[model samples]
Target: MIYVITIAIYLIGLVIIGFFKAKQIKTQSDFSVAGRALTPWVLVGTMLATWMGTGSILGNAGKTYQTGMAGLWLPLGSVLGIIILTQIAGKVRSYNKFTVPEIIGERYGQVARLLSVIALVLAYMVIVSYQYNAGGAVLHTIFTDDSGVSAISVETGTIIAAVFIILYTMLAGLLSVVYTDVANGIIILISFMIAIPIFLVEAGGFDGMQIAFSEMGKPEHMRFFGVYSFIDIINFCLPGFLLIMGDANMYQRFFC
Candidate 1:
């Protein structure tokens, strides 16, 4: 019931935001770049929030649970991406391109633009699908019961979530998405800060945590390096590194 109430509150908040934003919609540029009036803080907040979506939270948690501190490498890779982005921030803003394809076309050619569009569309679709799956898993865990709506099948729940995303995104476009991301980032950070300590205390402090970890047969899980080799870390970080070098989303945020 608490979980349902929480979700309801979030949905209501999103609806209210979308409702007001609808009135301000006018053009494609307005939809795509939010009129290019976003402040730096807003840009940073949205960038952090969008990057730290379902994949970052759930996927990272699962990775950390199984592979220990090696999971931190993912966030580390993201941080590197941000740092590299900073170097090109001025260039991106100067170019003032809305989409990746536009930037690629300007720099390279028509072929580059077309190829970029194809790759971006395919990658984004896959990303959205994964996020839908993650949300469904959360809902299923929260609302499970022997009966009553059958606790919502993962596929059904995912479809519903995806529909909401589509509607909200389609309504106000980047303006709505960026502002919501900023707000969500704040909420997520606060939630983690509060939850982690409470959870640690309940689990009985550092000493108790050690004992439990030993029982689970993974005492060194908290170490920074853990058991991963240098080669393993490089392999894990490579995709993120390459993506960051030429990510359209990062460039958009830079320009915005």
Candidate 2:
């Protein structure tokens, strides 16, 4: 009940932000890129939020649980990619096109632009599907009964999440996206700040980690290259790492 109330309040706040920002969006550029006026802090917040999604949290964390320390490869790769992106980020922003296709068309020709758009749509649709699924899973977990009966099915939860996302995107465009991203980042940071200490205390401290690992019978989980072949490491790191370098969201934020 408390959780639901908190979520309700948070959502209400987002809606308000969207409705407020919607009034200011008079041009296509304003809607698509927040008039290219996002401040550094807001840009940082959105970029961080975009980069750290359910994949970074639950998916990679699960991998870490299974493979121990080897799971760091994916996120480490992403971080390294971001560091590299800093080099060309200025170039991206200076190109000053509204859409990625426009930028490509200008440089590569119409055929390349068409291919890029097709690829972007296909890839983004897949990304949206996963995002909806992740939101649904979180909602289902939140609404599940003590006996583990879900109040809402995953499909229903997904639809609800998708609707909210669509509504917010239509309502305020990049303005709402960036503002809500900053808020989301703050909440996530606070959650980790509060939870990590409790988790550490529960699992016992540094010494306790060793004891816990020993009991789990997977002592190698604490190892840097735990159980991962060289091929596995490369394979795990490359996709996410490379993807971030060319992600639409990151590029959009840079353009802003």
Where model 1 places Cα greater than 4 Å from the true spot, the runs are: 146-150
lDDT (Cα) of model 2: 0.86
**lDDT value for model 1:** 0.80
lDDT of 2 by residue, 80-111 (tens): 88999999889989998777788899999999
Candidate number of the best lDDT:
2
Candidate 1 backbone overlaps, count: 0
Overall lDDT per candidate, in order of appearance: 0.80, 0.86
Output the lDDT of residue 23, model 2.
91
The stretch of ten residues in a row with the least summed lDDT in candidate 2 is 68-77
Clashes of each: 0, 0
